[model samples]
Target: MTVESPAGPSTGTSTGRRWHVLGAWLLADALALTGTRLAAVALPWLALTTTGSPTAAGVVAFAELAPLVVAKVLSGPAIDHLGARRVAVGCDAASASTVAAIPALHHLDALSFPALLVLVAATGALRGPADAARHSLVPVLAESTRQPMERVTGLASTVERTSSLVGAALAAGLVALVGAADALAVNAAGLALAAVVLGLGARSVGRGVPADDDPHSYLVRLRAGWQFLRRDPVILALTVMIAFTNLLDVAFTAVLLPVWAVETGSGVGAVGLLLAVMAATSVVGSLVAAAWADRMPRFAVYVVAFVVCGLPRFAVLAWSDVTSAPVVVMAVAGLASGFLNPVVGAVFFERIPRHLVGRVGAMSTAVAWGLMPFGGLVGSALLALLDLRAALLVAGVLYLVTTLAPVVDRRFRAMDRVPVEVS
Candidate 1:
C-alpha cells in the first residue's frame, strides 16, 4: 500500500513494515482512548455515588483538569528528551495502576475525596504526554508516504473519536451491568492493553526509536519549546483560538446542554442521542477530509472547521431547536470537527523541528485543554442568568468572532506556502 506524502511530488513506498506500525499505533490509541474515556465517563458517577453531593461532584471535575495545564506545560521537553514511546508506556502503566487502585480502595471503603482528586490529577498529567507521544508517532509510522502520513494522522482521529464514543458507551453499560468499581477496573485493563500494544508491537511496523538528542536538560528543553511558541505568531494565535474554543465547548457540553435538556424536557435519551450525533458526524467529516484532501486550502479548511463547529449554537437560539433537529445540526459541527483535525496536524508539525515535536505537541494540547475547566464553570454561572438557548447563542457569536483570528494573522496565512524537506 504505497502512499504519497501530502507535501507534494513524490510517493512513499508503503512496505509491510509500515502497516505493522500503523496497526500497532491504531490499537494503542484505541486502548488508551478507551481507558481515558471510560474513567471520565464513570467519574461523575463515582463522585455522586460516594459523596451524594452535586457540588462535590462538580469539584471533582475541577480537580481533574487543574493539573492538566501545568503538567502539559512542564512535560513537553521531558517527552522529547525521554522519548515519546517510553513516556507513553510509563504513563499508561501508571494510569492503569492508579485506576485499578480506585476499585481496590473502594472495596476496603477507604476511598476519600482527596484520594480521588490525586488519582484524577495523576491521570490528567499522564494524558498530556500520552497524547503527544501517540501523535508524534504518526509521522514515523508512515515515514515514506506524505499523503499517506497525512491520511494516517487523519485516520488516527477516527480511532480516537470512535474509541472515545465506544468507551463512554461501554462505561455506562459496565456501570449498569456491573458497577462503577468494575467499570474502573475495565478502564485499568484497557490502559494496560494500550501500554502493551505500544511497548511490544510498534517497532515491528516501521516505527523508529528517536535518537537520544540529549540536546538540553528537560527543563531547558521545556523552556525552549515555550520560547518557540512565543516566537511563532501563527502557532500562538491558533493555540489561543483552540484554547478559547475548548473553553466554550466544554461549557456547552457539560453545563449548557444539560440545563437545556432539563428545561425543554428532552431527557437523558435525547442527551445521549445529541452526543452520538456529534461524535458520529465528526467521523463522517474526517472521512470526507481523507477523500478530498486534494481539493482544500489547508489553512482555510482549518478555519472553516472552527466556524462550522461554532455555527450550530446560533442555530439553536434562532430555531428553538430541540434534540431531534439539533442532531442534524450537531452532525454538521461534527463534520467540521473532522475537517479541522488534519489541519491542526498540518500546522502543529509544520512549525516545530522533529526532535522538539513531543514536548511541543504535549505542551500545546495541555495548554489548550487546560482552558476547559474555566469554560465549564463559566457555563454553570451563565446558566443562572440566561436560559441555555441564550447562553449558546452568546457562545456562537463569540466563536464566530474568533474565526477571523487565524485568517487575519499573517504568519498563519503564510504557513501553507512554506516549503519543507522531509526524508
Candidate 2:
C-alpha cells in the first residue's frame, strides 16, 4: 500500500520501504492500546474485587476518561508543540511506569481505590500525547506524493481495533490463569515493550511545522484546535461522524454486549469470543483496505461500509427474541467493522492539513471519546429499559445514518480523483 498523504504539501516520493514503517507503527501502537485497554478492563475488575464497591469502578472510569477528554482536546496543540516523536515515546514510557506501579501497590495493599484511580489517571494523561504523536507519524512515514494515507491510516485503525482482540484475550487468559492484579503486572510489561518498539523506530514530529507554545492558559491553546476544526467543512463533518461512532461503539463494548450475551444465554465465554472474531476479521479487512484502497472511489466505499456498520445493530434488535439470533447479529456486526475502518481512515486523512494532523486528530478523537462515559451510562440504562438487542439496534441505526449523511455531498464523492499532487 502506498502510504501517501495527498492532501498535504508534497514531501517525499513513495518507495516499497515505507510500509514497514507503517507496520512498525501498527505493532507498537497495538501494544500501546493493548496496555491501555487491558488496564482499563482489568483495573476496574480488580478494584471492584478488592474494595467491593461500585464507587471504585465509577471513579476509575471517570479518572481515566476525564483526562482523555481534556488531553484529547488539548493534545493536538501539545503534539504540535512537543513534537510528535518525543511526545509519543515519552508518554508511552510514562504510561508503562504508571501501570507497572499498580501491581506492587496491590501486593503491599497500597492499591486503595483512590490510589488505583490516580495511577490509571496518570496513564490516561500520558495517552493523549502518544495518541497525537502516532497520528502525526502516519503522514510523515508516507510520501506526500502518490501515497495513500487513508490506506496507512486504515492499517493503523486495524491495530487500534485489533488491540481489543489482543487485550481481551490477554486479560482473560492471564487474569483467569493468574489473577487481575498479576494480569495488570503483565500489562505493564507489554506497555514497556510497545514503548521500546515505537521509541526505537521513532522519527521527529517532521520538519514542516513548529509547535506553537506561546505562553497561554491551556484552555486558550486548546480552543485553537476547536476553532480550526469548526471552520473546516470536511473535517467538521468527518469529526462528527467519527465521534458518533465512537460513542455508540464504546457503549456496545462496555455495556450492551455483556447484557446481550447474558440475556441470550450465550455465556460470557461466547461473548468474549465475539471480539476475537471481530479482530481477526478486522485484520484481514484492514489489509484488504490498505492493499486496494487506491483503486476505488473513497466515497462509494465509505457509503457502502457505513451501511454495513449500521445495518448490523438493527440486526441485533430485530433478532433479539430468537435464540442464537444475537450471535448471528454480532457476527455480522464484526464482519461489517472489518470494512468500516478503512473508509473511516480514508475520510479523515483526505481532508485535514498535515500541520494540523496531531491536534486536529487528537482534538476530534478526544471530544468524541468524551461521550464514552455517556455511552456506558446509556448502554446500562437501555439494557434496563429494553433488552440488549433492542437498545443497540436503535442506537446503532440512528447514529449510523446520521454519520453517513456527510458522504451525500458531491465534493466528498469527488475527493478520490483529486490526485496526489500536494499543493
**Tens-digit lDDT track of model 1 for 259-328:** 5655686643454456656777777777777667536787778777888878575557336646657877
CA RMSD (A), model 2: 4.9
Write down the lDDT of every candidate, Cα atoms only: 0.68, 0.65
Candidate 2 lDDT, 1-423, residue by residue in tens: 122231223337244334545556678888888876666556655654566543444455667767867776767766766667667777888788888888888789777777877887887777777776777777666553246776676677678768877777676566657777878876777777877877665332233344354676767766766777687665566566666776676566655554555466554444446655566666666777777776767667766666775657555644664435555655565555666666655655565566567767788777667776566556656656775567877777776676567566554554455435222
Candidate 2, TM-score vs. the true structure? Answer: 0.81
How many backbone clashes does every candidate have? 9, 4
Best by lDDT: 1
Q: Which segments of candidate 1 are over 4 A away from where they belong?
A: 1-14, 45-58, 144-149, 175-182, 204-215, 261-268, 313-322, 419-423
The residue-level lDDT of candidate 2 at 216 comes to 65
**Angstrom error at residue 6, model 1:** 21
Question: What TM-score against the true fold does each predicted structure earn?
Answer: 0.85, 0.81
